[model samples]
Target: MFVGAIEKVDQFTRPIHFIFRYYTGSDIVPGTATLFFVNEEGFAITCRHVARQILYANSIYENYLKFRGELRKFEKDPGFETQRTNLENKYKISAANPIRVLFNFIQCVSAYKAMTIHLHPTQDLAIIQFKEFESVQYQGYAQFLKDSRFAKQGRYLCRLGYPFPEFTNYQYNKVSGDIEWTKEGRSKTPSFPIDGIITRHIGEGSEITGIEMSTPGLRGQSGGPLFDPNGTIYGMQSATRHLHLGFDQVNREVVSDGQRRRVSNYPFLNVGQCVHVDVIKQFLREKKIKFYEQD
Candidate 1:
C-alpha cells in the first residue's frame, strides 16, 4: 500500500509525494490510495478513480477554491452588482472545459514529466505507467490466475490497502492560492487486510464479469489487489454495496425538540466488488503490457 500527494509549494515546482503524503510538520497521508506493482519496470495498477485524482486533483480543488472565493466576495459585498457578475462569468467559463483546467494544472504541478493512464473501457480497473522513472522496486509483485475456473463461490480471498488516513494534513493556503499538506501526521498503520468469501460471480452464466466478495470495500481499498491463499491475484477491489438496515432509535424529546430523529448508524454488509482478473488481462494484452499469470 502507498500514500502520498501531488504537492505544490510554488508556481515553478511541484513534486509528487509517493511514500507518504506529507512528513515534514506532521506525519500524514493525503489523497491516499492503495497501489501494487504489476511488473518490475515501475508499472502499477489502481482504480481508475484514484488515477483520476492523481492526475487531476489539483484542478478540481482549484476550481473549488475559485468558487468559494467568489462566494465569499458575494457575502462581503452583498450590494455590489459587479462582484456578482464577475462570479457568474467565472462559473460559465469554468464549466466549459474543466478537463483543460486539469491538464493545465498537471503541466504546472507534477514534477515528473509524463504519465500514461489506461482505463478499462467497461471495468473500474486502470493501468498506470510511469514513463520517466525506472528502477522502482516493491517488496513483491503479484501474478494473476490465468484460469477463470478458480473464481468460484465460497472461495476465500484477501485484499490489502491503506484504507483511510490515520491523520490528514490537508489544508488550503489562502495566501498562495494553493492546496497544501502540512508536513505532519502519520500514515495509516498496519496496512488493512480484508478477508472474505466469494459470494458469487458477476455477469450471466458462462460469461464471468466481476466478483462479489463478502467484505465491504472501504474507501482507501479502491484499486487494491485481491489475492487468494495460493498467491494468485484474482482481481482488484473496486466498490461496495451498502444495504441499509433499520433507522436509528433516538430520543427525540431530548436529542431534538420535536423532529424525526434517526441516527445514520445503519447495519451494512461489506459486499466488496472486484474487477475480474480476465478484464485486467484483456487490458494488458490490448496495451501490450507485460504481466505474469499462471498457465
Candidate 2:
C-alpha cells in the first residue's frame, strides 16, 4: 500500500533540470533548472524565476561535476574511461562537482483532461493538460491528477519532489550519465511529502483565500501537483514563507557628483499564495487542452 501511494504522487511531479548559458569574468557557464512536467504532455510548469534563462548569472555555483571533471575532458577522448573509473573510485565524489536531476515530462495533452496552465510566472500559476499514456509503470495518470469528484476541503493531500540540494548522479563517461537515471528510464521519483487542507474551493475569481497549507513545502516542490485522498489534483504546490510587511519609499538623495539615487521594492506581502484553479482553467481554455478523469 505504501509503495502504491508513492507511485500515485510520482505520476504528476517530475524532477526538473534545465541547461542555461551564462557569462562569467571570462568563460560562459551552463546551468539547469530544478523542474518537472505537469499534466504530462511534455508541457512542464516551473517557477518563472526558476526557469528564467539568464545570460549572466553569478549567483549560481556548483553543478554537473562528473561532466566538468577530467573524466568529462576525456568524454570523447580515447582511452580515458580507465582513468575516469579510477578517479571516481578514489574521490567517490568531488567537492566541486554540481549535481541536478533529470526527468521526462511526457507529451500527455489532449481533450477533456481538465488540465491547463492556470497562472503565469508573475502570478505563479500554470495550467496543464494530462493525456493518458499506456504503461505498466504509471498505469496512466488518470488515476492521479485527472479526477476532481473527490475534491473536498479537509481531504488528505500529497506532495512529491527531490528537494535535496546536495543532489548527485554517477556517470560512465562524458556522453553517458548515471546508468539508472540517464538511459535507464526513471520517472517522477518522490523525495518527500506532507499533509495540508484546501481551505476552500477556489474556482475562477473566488473571494475565498487563505494560507492553503499549514505545513511547509520544499524549494524544488514549487510546481508539484497537490492531490486529495481520492487522488484528484486540488492544487499545485505554490509557495510558503513567514509573512512580512514593510513600506517602500524612494530614498532619493543627491551625491556631490550631482547624481540622484532611488530605491523601490514591493512590501506588505503575506505568506503562501496560489494562482487558484480559476486561473488554471483559463489557461487550459487558451491552450485548448482537456483533462483526463477516471470514474
Each model's lDDT: 0.62, 0.45
| Tens digit of per-residue lDDT, candidate 1, span 1-295 | 1111111101111112222222122322343456666766556777787677666656655665676676785676757667756765765434333322211111211244677888777777788776764344343456789897878899888877656555443454569644455666542233566788999888756767689998788777787777876557888888997656566544433455766564544455659998898888888889998988865
Model 2 has a clash total of: 29
- Local lDDT at 2 for model 1: 16
User: Which regions in candidate 2 have their CA more than 4 angstroms from the true location?
Assistant: 1-5, 18-40, 53-122, 127-139, 142-153, 170-190, 199-211, 244-273
Total residue pair clashes for candidate 1: 12
Best by TM-score: 1
Candidate 2 lDDT over 1-295, as tens digits, reads: 2345557656645555332222212222222223334343444555544433221122232333533565666777677877766765564434333233222232233233332333463456554333353422222442333334455456556655556533333223434432223443333334666566544453435453222654566666676656555555555666775444556555645454576666565565333334444444445556675545444
Residue 31 lDDT in candidate 2? 24
- TM-score: model 1 vs. ground truth: 0.68
